[model samples]
Target: MLAIPAVPDVPDVPDGARPRWSVMIPVHDCAGYLALALPEVLAQLGDRDDAEVVVVDDASTDDPGAVVARLGQGRVQYRPNPGHLGAIGTFNRCLTLAQGELVHLLHGDDTVLPGFYPATEAALADPAAVAAVCRVRDVDADGGPLHTTRSYRHGTGVWCDALESLALSNRVRAPGVVVRRSAYEAVGGFRTDLPHAADWDMWTRLAAHGPVVFVDEVLACYRRHAASDTSTRVRSGANVRERVTVVGVVLGYLPPARRAPLARRAYAYAAVFAARTALQQVRAGRLPGAARQLREALRCLALIPRGLPRPP
Candidate 1:
């Protein structure tokens, strides 16, 4: 088994020194994007003492530290991991290092739009909700617009049925959501096991604790490039298997009475989507990959009738 590297010493927060918000950017080798993203993030902070920005460099071979020093200009607190910690490990490290009422785990490649802070903060003002999410706009590697995903319901309010919506699909992009630190500590950090679905898993678990507020406007941009972890996994067909596993995990977190019906709905949806992907693969002349995906689609369809779910 591959082991995750140990986290080095993170700067300690003085006793009773808590900020209103901690915007944590975890970067591996996305310095180009970081240069663009940092300015936007810092703009949102606007020299506010109650907000802090922390950038975690996971021992990248690239000069992310130099980038931070140059663009961040002594404003962003920079921490470099002693060794390599993968995305999940780095996320856990961010949770450990964050000392704020709310934590925004923004990736180095993603950017938040103006009004993200005020809108999300207002939504989370409800004491009953543990987290808040806004709509996400998908952008290309060059920051050109691709498409926008309206992950939440069509209004600006707290959604009590967040788990049900999340069970269907992950509506919260990492950059678009801000979670209360207390809720993160209670549910634990992102699961290392579900690499592709870690964010989805975290959303489902957090939703279980309390309601989730949704902002109707697009508040963040998610970059889809070839080098991104999601793209790499999808190309290798790992995401297909991980998607099945994520659905099962979400099912386990739901009430037992609601599990069976939701499983049927979820697997049925997966089967249809997989079949479409298989057809696309075949059209692209990847015969073996298409056959494998066809088999997965059939397997998902078979499970729908039995109402029996299994983890990958």
Candidate 2:
């Protein structure tokens, strides 16, 4: 349904030997961070063999392959794109290349804690679960702890309010969630148009199919740096504009009766975020970016037309 590229034939490997998990790290120009991520991933694997670690470089100028070679040797596979495809392209490419039942779309820079795999695997062990999301701890570029995502549940269990809650706002960070590959096939690839907010679109869609598991403990680290896409969007005011589009797309997924109230809630939250970013931009003398953010704040439900396209 996602119109993904035709997958190649699987050369049959005995079930015991084939990898059950693929930790695919999609990267652009972030080799320095890749150096740190590889070891942490492998360390969790230990002597276990049912995991594949891949670095899918998005035609970055720097050499992340050397980092993979130095740290991983043959354990980690390094796959480089022929050309630069930006975030949307690279992420789709990672999905295409992934060869495991469970897919972890880890960033080139992020690292999972020692307990992450075990915790997530435990949650996914529930046959009804289509995906498992762990709480995320935000870290600075130097890997210093910033803050953790607010917990949606009191402790680890099924996320009962997942769909309605995510329709209002995305709480997922890429490294913090491990998704079943089947979920991707069902939802389709990330929307090519929503570059800045595709993950939000994807997670919200996934929540609809899920008995999603919430691992309340913070098991994944999401790095924040000036060069990161989130930061760039904030500086340019694209975050607000992109979120407005994503909110409209997501509203189409819910029942008509719920859309009005949720749309109001979503738009208000985005407006508040934009206003806060606008003030920060003003303090930094980025007047144009501040003005751009303010303009997006006023783009409410009326901007979203009727007969919107729903998720696959």
Candidate 3:
């Protein structure tokens, strides 16, 4: 086996001086993007003494440390993993190391817009809310706009019926949300078994405990690139399998009476997504991959009850 590279050292924070907000960027070998992402994040923090930024490098071969060191300007903290930790492990580590009342686990390549902090902080102001999410703009690799998303209806200062909305789909992206640290501790960090839909799973768990607030405006950018883990997982069909498994896990969080209806809707949605994936595979002339996706789609469809109406 090849040898693993050692991580760079990070400065230790003094005990009992936790910040109000901890922006944790978990990165793996995407230094170029990190160079772009960190500046915006720091600018958003804007001399706030009550907030700290941390970059958790997950044993990437590339020089993410140097990128953070340069753009971070000594404001951002760096914590490189001692060994190779997968996405879930890296995320759990970020939660563990973060010392804040609220934590935002921003991806290395994604960025938050100007109003992200203020908007999300306001949404989480309600003591009953455990988390807050805002709309996101999906951008290309070079930070050009692709499309914006509004998973929930447009309305400022709205508290979503999170459990009801999240049961249908993963409405919130990881980069577009801020979670309370205490809520995270209550539910535990991201599940190790869920490689693809862990964020969705985490959201569902959080919503079950307390209300989740929504900010109407676009507050973050989700970078879409060929090299992204999402793209790779979608192509490999791991995304399909893991998403199906996630729906099952999330259903268990619901009351017994509500589980069947949600499960039916969830499986139907998965089937439709898989069917679309199969079509895309066919368009690319990958007949074998298309066949595999078709099979998965059929399996999902079969899981749904026979007489249930299809999701709109």
Candidate 4:
């Protein structure tokens, strides 16, 4: 049985202390892009008396030390892991070290718009909000917009309805979301074991605990490049297994009565994703890869109840 680790409690803010926000950026061989991302992050600081920028270098052979060192200053807190901890481990460590009201897991290659701080500050004024997530624009490596922002729209505020939406698809891009320090700690932060779907796991856990406000405005830019891990996941099709693991976690967290419906959707999504992967492999003339995808499809079917409606 996999146990969700306990998220540590954040200390109470001292009176008169400057309001601070902790931003964690994890990078591996992303030197070329951080140059643009770092400055944009600093610009979003606004009037906050304190802001801590945590950058973790995951043992990249491409001189990550030199690149990060150049960007480091009084406001930026940089820590380089001894060796490669991979992206998930790096993010977990970053969250563990945060001391602020809000935590932002900004990817090393992604940049926030100038208005990000003002928008977040206003939304978090509500005491019930555990997280404030805004719209995000996907851009090429050079920061050109891919198209209209990828929509994660559901409603203005977080509630049970948002949880159902997430079960269907992960509309919340990892970077655009800002989490309360206490909320993140309560959910035990990110689970390193599920490296591929760590963000999905965190989002699910957070939604289960509290309401997540969706700010429809696009406050950040997600930089997409061929070399990015996400692109690699699409090319190799490992996203299917990760999504399966996520559904299992969701089912484990839900009540028995609610499990069947959620499981049905999950299994169907897994089957479709696996079939798509198999078709892609066939087109590439890789017989073995295609066969493996077919096997995955069968496993997905086994998880679904026989009488459940098929996923669209």
lDDT of each: 0.82, 0.81, 0.80, 0.74
Query: RMSD in Å for candidate 1, one decimal?
Result: 3.5
Misplaced by over 4 Å in model 4 are: 10-14, 68-73, 147-155, 271-312
The residue-by-residue lDDT of candidate 4 on 66-151, one tens digit each, is 66578654567668897777887788777777777788988888888878867876778887888888888888877888744444
Full ranking by lDDT:
1, 2, 3, 4
Candidate 2 C-alpha lDDT tens digits along 187-265: 7777777777888888888888778999899899999988887878887777877787777788767888888778778
Ten contiguous residues minimizing lDDT sum, candidate 3: 1-10
Relative to the unseen true structure, what is the C-alpha lDDT of residue 174 in candidate 4, on a scale of 0 to 100? 78
Candidate 3 global lDDT: 0.80
What's the TM-score of each model vs. the native?
0.89, 0.89, 0.88, 0.83
User: Whose TM-score is higher: candidate 2's or candidate 4's?
Assistant: 2
Stretches off by above 4 angstroms in model 2 are 1-13, 279-288, 298-312
lDDT of 1: 0.82
Writing each residue's lDDT as its tens digit, candidate 3 over 286-306 gives: 777787788888888887875
* lDDT measured at residue 96 in model 3 versus the true structure, 0 to 100: 84
